[model samples]
Target: MCSGDAATVPGGHADRPARPQPHGSLLNPLHLLYLACFLSQSVFLSAQFALLLYALQLPLSPTMAGLLISLGGLGPALIAVNIGKFIDRRGARSPMLVALAAQLAGAALPALSQSLPVLFLSSFISGTAFIVFRIASQQTVGRLGDGSTRAKHFGHLGLVYSVATVAVPLAAGYAIDHAGFAATFLGNALLALLPLVAIASSIIAIPGPAASAASGGRGNSAFALLRDPALRRLMVATVIINGAWDVFMFLAPVYGSQLQWPASRIGTLTGSFAAGAMFVRAIVSLLTARFTSWQILVMALALAGACFALMPAFVTLPLLLAIAFLGGMGMGVALPVTMALIFETAPVDRAGEVIGLRTLINNVSQASIPLLAGAVGALIGLAPVFWGLATAMLGMSWSSRAYWRSHRRKGQSPGGTP
Candidate 1:
């Protein structure tokens, strides 16, 4: 898991290297971290969509269903900054161990669940743990290698999630159709095994804070990200894109229901989103070899925003499908790119806090934006929420552009420095 931070690679492709994969493959300890991250996260993320579908068969209303999803999410959102700070103070090991435990506990609830209360508590446990694992994975990437490999390493990690996310839902759908909700949780239980492997295999240790004391003391909260102008700008960008992505994902069920779409069709609509996101991100991996991440961000956000602007106008199934594809593509590309930027911009020792802060902002929007969509959807209708989301994304495009432009100037010093 150990390697030098620097390596030779073409520009614009900084995150992912242009070189071919070396003799060491997934068996390599460093690469195994990527494998572990990919497998465990897919279990959490894919089951997320599958869980709601399972809930749909329950007595819960649409809003209640949404509330449950939000509730599961709330624990992580509230605790991420604190957990992140602890990672910065301590290291990835402890938080990651805690996260896996939480995930295992949470995943089991649905397997054991016979009632609503049990389901919710399980979901709550999951929400708390998943974020810790996510932050730790990112920190592991930072600790195990240098900037030369971070982007490419992250790109590889993204590929694993993309592939697994695609498979999990289809399998869950089958399980839901035949074996029922608890069966899907069985897969989740299986996913929990990945963390154990990671914990056992990690040869890389999280460096103590004194390793980079110049970044300042461990007492610095997640709020300390505000001290860096570039980092603040990146967080703002994450919120904008993430919020816009949620507007449709959160409200689309109502839209489909209004259109009198069946459960199967509604499932397909969301499935289409995952499909599009999965494919587009795969493309981004190749594109990264040619384009700088900033360029990719512009392309992804512009198309995503444009897609949001178009969502309301579709009445026919084909039109809806087209919207889903565009929206999904945009959604897929934003996440990995954002992670690359965060790791690229922040100091390695302090990466946990930066990711925590960035994730905290994203979690706020993940919580709040849907509420905005529901309220706004109640008012002008869901169609207009797409337009509103599109408008917000447009603002994001400009702000993100400006933020990067300012930083580019700073990075362009006679002797370049971030």
Candidate 2:
């Protein structure tokens, strides 16, 4: 068994020096690579969304534009787990290199040919690349450190993406407003080079499996992880909370449009949410030290649900922004904790597969939830959408309580529970 003070041994060995802990400096090559990868992802997403807006300006139908934009998500949902399997068998380096190449091609394609077919093709390729990059990066990060160090790195990773989520869009919008869409796409394509160079230079440093043993026999698959009752509860909670986040993103703009809120105000409201997330992520290490993952997940979900439920009741921008901030805090706190829990609980050899499965679940939810919410909004009105999400979160809080009780019965400490 792995101890807090001892390093985890490979091949089920109880006695061995643990891998070197990650350095604290942001200048470390691995940390730089992490930053670059996240920045690239942010740029890619911003550019892709900008592409849709540009498509609309090109007189493409809104439906066609949406289809083009959604193609990015489609590829990942289909192949994320397979890519994870490849990472498990081979290593992160090759898949990361491949993903970068695809990202380059995807960004360049649309810049070179502004046609509908090229746009569609680029979206699919880029989307697939994005997922591949994410899985590889996440697996690599997981391998970089142990215990608290692992948790810290994952927290930083989440923060980078959170910041990127806010910054990239604003930057992309500015680029489109000034330099135009093609320039923005070309810039993103060029930005992809930074991570490529970083990964290439540091390829030798990327961690590999300590041993060649797989998690279990061939019958033990990614889906099998879901069979663990505790893990299942965590996964369900993650799915519901994340699904609510997607709904909020979708409904926020739609709701703003209905209320005739200015674009600037709507943007600020959304940005507030990101700000809240960043704030919580900034302090997640300290928070994790104090609270159990179960407690964090339950509290964040319940609070975020209350925030969502309150959203429809307000018309003033300040109240809305406050709600957004609170909601963001809830999600922000839950994300890293859930991620840490997954890493803590997953079998060592199957880390890549399990993370990929998590990605697959998240991708599926993101893709499907918004569509379903939109449909429900059309039938009953948008207020119910937020209400429904709120109710789901409130319900998940009880599940969390059950999990907490079960853990206590097993004599597990808050920090000790996987």
Candidate 3:
């Protein structure tokens, strides 16, 4: 899995000069790579959403549509750890290229065939490729700099991603409504090619592990990483915050449906949330400069909880949009901060693996939370789902406070603190 050209200095090479790290410039190729990663991911997600709707139109049963949609995560969840190990052993470049190719093929499959089997296969391939692409991009950003510089880069990364998250789905939905599903899928496949080209053109400049660091040194196992108190707390916080997002997306539509809101109004509610997220992410670096990641994360969770708790009571469109926007800001602000903390605290050699582990947790949450929300909604009502998530967010905020206090009491500097 290793690369021949990869910088790998043997042990006792103290005299060997360190390889030059990128200057964390906004215009660097690494940033370009980040943009490509964001676009690829956005396209994949939008297409997946579109695909589900398309599948429903194919006269498939609701259960069958759900199955087709969930199939995308199945392959990635199984092999994420191995994918991380491969990136750690070799480098992100090879895998990034491979993921792009897989994305192209995955998008092509659904466009070319309307059969259920082909769609299932497309989801599997696309899901696996998405994880690989994410791991590579995250690893590169983690390695691009340290401290504030790293935080700034990650802020920019999250901002682009948030923007794409809001815009791409709307665009895809428009295309689907106007041009039809086949054309939309075909366009997505073509869009995947732009990133593939970008990556191929900038292959020489993609940031990766240094020679000495990539020299086959042993590192902590994934379980061992989990055992670290700080990382464990980070993981829990990540799961909770990310899980809330899943719950919100699923529940918002259900809530709207129950209230007899039009589909366009429901879309606006969700879009408002994304708009809030995009707003905070745009200014994340400034916020990080003044507050530690832990502080920001805790406060964001608390605010998000309050917003969620209030969400069930709002029935008017403007009022609902306002609550969703505030809640979006709460949820949006935590994402990059959490990610920055994970990278800041991770073992250098194991960053890829740790990120893979995080992705694994996120994928599991995305798959399971909706089903959990649905069951809970059926048993009690949709309001309880929002209330339950509000409770979880408040709980995680408390735990985050405890985690930071514990670290400080032990005289440990978690870094990125103001």
**Residue 145 miss distance in model 3 (angstroms):** 2.5
What TM-score would candidate 3 get against the native? 0.86
By TM-score, is 2 or 3 better?
Answer: 2
Please rank every candidate by TM-score, starting with the best. 2, 3, 1
Runs of candidate 1 exceeding 4 Å displacement:
1-23, 42-69, 109-120, 142-152, 173-187, 201-210, 213-218, 256-269, 314-320, 406-418
lDDT of the candidates, in the order given:
0.67, 0.76, 0.77
Clashing pairs in 2: none
Better of 1 and 3 by lDDT: 3
Query: How do the residues 306-350 of candidate 1 rate in per-residue lDDT, one tens digit apiece?
Result: 888887787777877888888788767777776776656664445
State residue 286's C-alpha deviation in candidate 2, in Å.
Answer: 2.5
Give TM-scores for every candidate, taking all chains together and pairing residue i with residue i: 0.78, 0.89, 0.86
Tens-place lDDT per residue, model 3, 166-223, is 6887898899899988888888888778888877887435655545447774655686
lDDT of 2 at 102: 82
Best by the TM-score measure: 2
Per-residue accuracy of model 2 over 1-418 as CA lDDT, tens digit each: 3325354443221112125654676676457767766866875687587778878988999788888887888656677777877787777887888888888888888778898888888888888888888888888776765555555567788888877877787888898899988888888888777777777887435665535423332337679877766567667777887898888888898889889999998888887887888998898878768766667778888889899889999989999999999999998877776776676666566667777888889878888999999999999999999999998988888777776777678766333233
Selected candidate, larger TM-score, 1 vs 2: 2
